[model samples]
Target: MAVRVLAAGLAGLVAAAGLAACTPAPSGPPVAVLFPGAADDDWGASAEVLRRELADDGYAVEVRFAGDDIPRQLEQLREVLAAQPAAVVIAPVDATAIAAVLTPDAAGEVSVIAYDELILDTDQVDYFATFDHRAAGRLQAQALVDGLGLADDPDAGPFAVELLAGSGDDRGAQDAFAGAMEVLQPYLDAGRLTVPSGRTDLEQAAILRGSPATAADRVAELLAADVPLAGVLSPSDAMSGAVAEVLAAAGVEVVAPGARWSAAPLPPEGEPSATPTPPGATAPPPDATTPPHTDAAPDSAADAAHDRAAPASVVLTGGGSTLDGVRAVRNGAQTATVYEDPRELARAVASMVREVVEGAAPTVTQGATTDNGVRAVPTLLREPQLVATVEEARRVLG
Candidate 1:
């Protein structure tokens, strides 16, 4: 299985050589790995991984972080292009904002791989390599379900859930929430889970650019609204931490005691026609299927809210394999986090780069292509793994 997936991942790189063979040979200049945010914990981790992996493949790689400035990143990118590298891998801060700077005309015809984030409205991108973010959301939902003992005890009262998402501009947030809602919406529909603040839209749940401060502010609003929360759908560890912090400040615990969970299997890929029936759900009748779910959570959720102990944590889930996220899972603050293997991403991107530099026609038959409002960019995607327990998080992340 692993071998097959790896081969599929390299399909685009394999084509690169053939297609670009007519072009002049790529230069001896070092390749550039650009990050939208250099100091960011998650992006930094992936950048480090890329550096090591690409170096091992004999690519002299130079990594640059675009520190919170749009023009700065563009300048840095232009500078890198000035050096005449064979290819460049970029995870842009603003997908649309960076499009003009990356024009092959301006950059002097370098092959560019859109890493992680999709670069939109342009034909400059050669390939898009990222994990199935929607799968990340599904994993988050499943982990939350398991952590709350919903699947373990169907009789367990429906839990109150708060939904949060990544950047609104990001396709990842769209896909993640869409996928999460696919698994969780039924529960919302079936009276198994809910959002107390009634904020279901990805926009309402968004944490700008995965900003912790934005998440904290939203969480504060939820607290001010006096809504009870038993579970939260956090897209990344940073947002999870922010949510956790505000709850702590409000004198609420971050992890419920005596909580136990086992990982649940995910639904099949390619968006299964019919997702597995949410645990404890019943097939609706042909008529009279609507339940007046006026309130977000049921009576039990309110009960849990009213009789909270001095310190009690809520069930939470996130994605990414950043150091903080891994430690949170290990320490039990986060019930689970989906780890989209960065090593695989690096390997595939590196392979794609090498092929492009060799002037090959890289064809990617694997993974889905996302239409970036202009053209469909071929993608290489990997599935993320759920890390629930301290032991599990440590084993995988350490």
Candidate 2:
């Protein structure tokens, strides 16, 4: 019965995505990249890197935001393809629905590279550049293992773990869960970790369900649950922040998988200068490693504005330099995060686009395909490093 119910749910989701599943990639510019969300969002930071690098390499790059709307994104892609660029780069907001449209017929005219987020039709996309998200999950689990010293003493029975998945529509979130599970399975098999019911929280769904408060409430509920949790598999630093607030307020020592940027691992950090604010309002205390925030009520645009205006420190993470996610890891803020140098990725894509435009075939390393509704796609996967802590960040940041 349970299996049937799950299948039905999946089918229903697919059914609702009728036109979305079969759409194909359209021909477009030498390099047209779509940003599915706001440019300033952390996830969008990667797009910026790609844009800057591609521009530096003398490529014409057109960037557009999808504004969190799938239909709008599709329309944008159609328009972009009409321009007939050599290739189109995309970070899809909804992989499944977007996959419906990424047909080779749409993409056959151009080379496509699915950035960070994996797009469905593999045959159409010539290259894929992203972090080894699965490995990131393993790193998060490993961090919990080390933090709890599970390896040293195997007798730690039944530590609880909650999975705060990113948007349900995000493939990275799904992959991160898989990666985390790979590391956690051993502990689960040994009865060393216990995942409680209602532990799998999806942020976007919560919003869609009109329960934005559920995120914090759920974390609080989990912490207060009878079973004790050793940690949580948080897909992003933002989620970790919410979980942290609840745990901190409850005086519970909770663990979560956080990204390198939020987990600045250093101490006595070089504090950046703060912009002067109104005399009545005082500056929030600096986290030294994490982004700043204002303690204001929800829906307070003024408060949100205040938080954004604060001068933030530049912590190194998410890219493979010699530095890893050092600051966040040392500060116990992040467990692990993906690091893919967009400079390298952009250069590769630029070259691939050029090849596609010149009617030259792109070289493929490891051939693989992801199923778009109509067909399978040929793909080249890029490797990404998962980093944790100040030392690791320092090692990579260099």
Candidate 3:
């Protein structure tokens, strides 16, 4: 019996040695990428890109989709936490609601990043990687005003404008509305643009998740009143087409985002500075042949030569590459859509992961901090582009 016991112990020791010898030193740890909704359109594209980038950076990546199910997302997150991944990039289905599961207690040392949408009411989020949503909102509103020729013509006269806000749960939606209002409030205050439907408030105008069905139903209600809508502030590409369809059915002329663009130098920001302003508002024509009389730069001779040589080109601008947005621009249903490049966002997330894992500061172009109910979360904002025309769309999206 003693001899038998000794042989069994020796066998167990040999098995343990074999297992240890085969086990390679841990180089990279498992990383879980969780999305509140299924990888669909821009969100999906971003997730896939992040996954690929993470793998390239030497991490085992796993992606899980919530299919827009809140409970399911919470469960998936719980499961991910249980596995003790090295890090996670979570796009919450409900920013405020997911706070319970994403708390520091739940995450332990696992770093958590809020993707695109800001996770509100929580201090547990370690970082944020997304585009400038407020800027996007501003861009969307600017497109509508430009398409309607309202910027130049305040006497474009009390034209009816209907505003649409994205889903209520989305903080980005609120930011977009805020940004749009920044430019539009002046016009609205001056009686140039009016909301006949009285659905001007962000909460009142929002369609959940910018769903097409919701937009169609709500827009149909607005159309029933027979009040002409010179412009509609669409919250997103997903809802833009449905809203446009309703408008077209009612016989309203639709100017797709890229329908009319001039071969002019891109303005610094905001709406094109040189526009046909409402009669009272003084603005220069885009193609005023005479140069401004302001004192020229120090290198006036060289600058003038460079300026004359620099040919102006029509810039394609818009936010996302969603099929609806692309098709709308192609069909001239809506003006331009903001092209918040998912690749850039993906790269940001990958870079963030690299930094957080290594205990280094993530590179942020803008050191902006947003309060997510609990504490101000450090954020990185990616610059978004405006995609103007079909040809531009092909190049940008492809």
Candidate 4:
């Protein structure tokens, strides 16, 4: 399976090489910006890539790190907004808190490009660049299903699951959970997954640290449970890494078949979809219908969120912890790691920012609308890559 996916990825890269050559020359110095949080964060990888991509476009970039403090970030944004930059790219710590600094009146003059995360009130920002986060969740869930071969038998028993989501304060985390549930719903509803109560917030760092003893108590229950955990769905690569440590201590193997991957296109669309047939198994068509979309009004999504049915014999892992997760996959400590090409996502943002600064419609793909109370946000849904070990990493990272 790795060999086939790697071949497809290599072909896609080779094909994209030509288009890479035809990219337009830089229009001006790369836009200056401020990013939320510490530079070492797993979430900041894409932001760093955007910083580099802007420099490559010949823009003079100035980045102020606003250490996840919403108030401080707002102050920084106010200061940067006043400077009248060609554009101010930001990954807001509190998407809504940043609203006070960004008003429709103040937003028109300079390009405000939200990178990785969608800033609330899209009507206020000129453009947004991010991976298709919902798709990312679906990818993670599918990987769990695939690794455990859940689709093969409907009668298979539920796999014990542990779920550790990111801060519910972050909408992206919610979206990631939603996407994964989209895939897991069928299996879960069918009793293929048994989710213990305290699992949802199990691996959150802040929550755990805030109440160490309580958190440890819950984790201990999970650790002592006799049932084998089919897998866990952590919200990012970081959480997945933490879960891997816990599961390793518990002595269970982890496998990820549809780990995270960038939504970059293959060398050509319609490239043959290659998948292997497990012994005694009839292979599913490469283009078999992806999980159903259970379409619902965007406005009511929060209140009536789409949950999943159950699946058989699966351990689901979520989170795009990237490099660390990839390392785990390589060492066989993990089944797979979600591979999000920070470089590509960054370039997409750079291009969109450039367009906004230059007063042109952005080139980013506009997909389904996401509601964040302020307004309906048009999102760019980039595909994610799933990396299964060091070998797959070499193929995509190169």
lDDT of each: 0.74, 0.56, 0.70, 0.61
**Residue 115 lDDT, candidate 3, scale 0-100:** 84
> How would you encode candidate 4's per-residue C-alpha lDDT over 1-398 as one tens digit per residue?
99999999999998788667776455565466677666787546656777777767667777877886888888888877777778888888777777777986666577777777778754676566677777777777777776656676565555666655555666666677777778877787787776765343324422331232443343445545443445666556655555555554544435544342111123456665332222122433322243434344333322222122112122435446356666666655666656676667777777777677667877857456666566666556567787755687666655
| Model 2, TM vs. native | 0.63
lDDT of 3 by residue, 1-398 (tens): 99999999999999999977875434577888988556665567878898888776668888998887899989999999998887888888877778888777788989888887878877778888778889888887787667656666545555676788887767777888898899889888988878878887788887786787787677677556444445667767767667666655654445544543232345687854442222112333323444566544535433333333111111122345455576667666567788676677888889889888888887765659877878888889877666656676677656
Q: Which stretches of candidate 4 lie over 4 Å from their true place?
A: 1-30, 38-48, 121-123, 196-219, 255-316
Off by over 4 Å in 3: 1-26, 39-44, 153-155, 258-321
RMSD versus native structure for model 4: 17.6
State how far residue 97 of model 1 sits from its true place (Å): 2.1
Candidate 1, residue 7: CA error in Å? 51
Q: TM per model?
A: 0.73, 0.63, 0.73, 0.69
* Model 2 misplaced stretches (Cα beyond 4 Å): 1-29, 38-45, 96-108, 121-126, 198-215, 254-327, 335-348, 358-367, 394-398
> Whole-model lDDT, candidate 2?
0.56
Poorest lDDT segment (10 consecutive residues) of candidate 2:
310-319
Per-residue lDDT of candidate 1, residues 1-398 (tens digit):
99989998798777887667744443345789988766456678778877776676566888898867888888988898788777889888788887877776766777888988888988878788888898898988888887778877877646677888888877988999998988888788889887877788887877677898887887777665555566788889888888878877776556532365322344568653322222222333322333543333324443333433221346778787556777787876777788877777777777777777778865454657889878899887777887877778778865
- What TM-score does candidate 3 get on C-alpha atoms? 0.73
Error of 2 at 133 (Å): 2.1
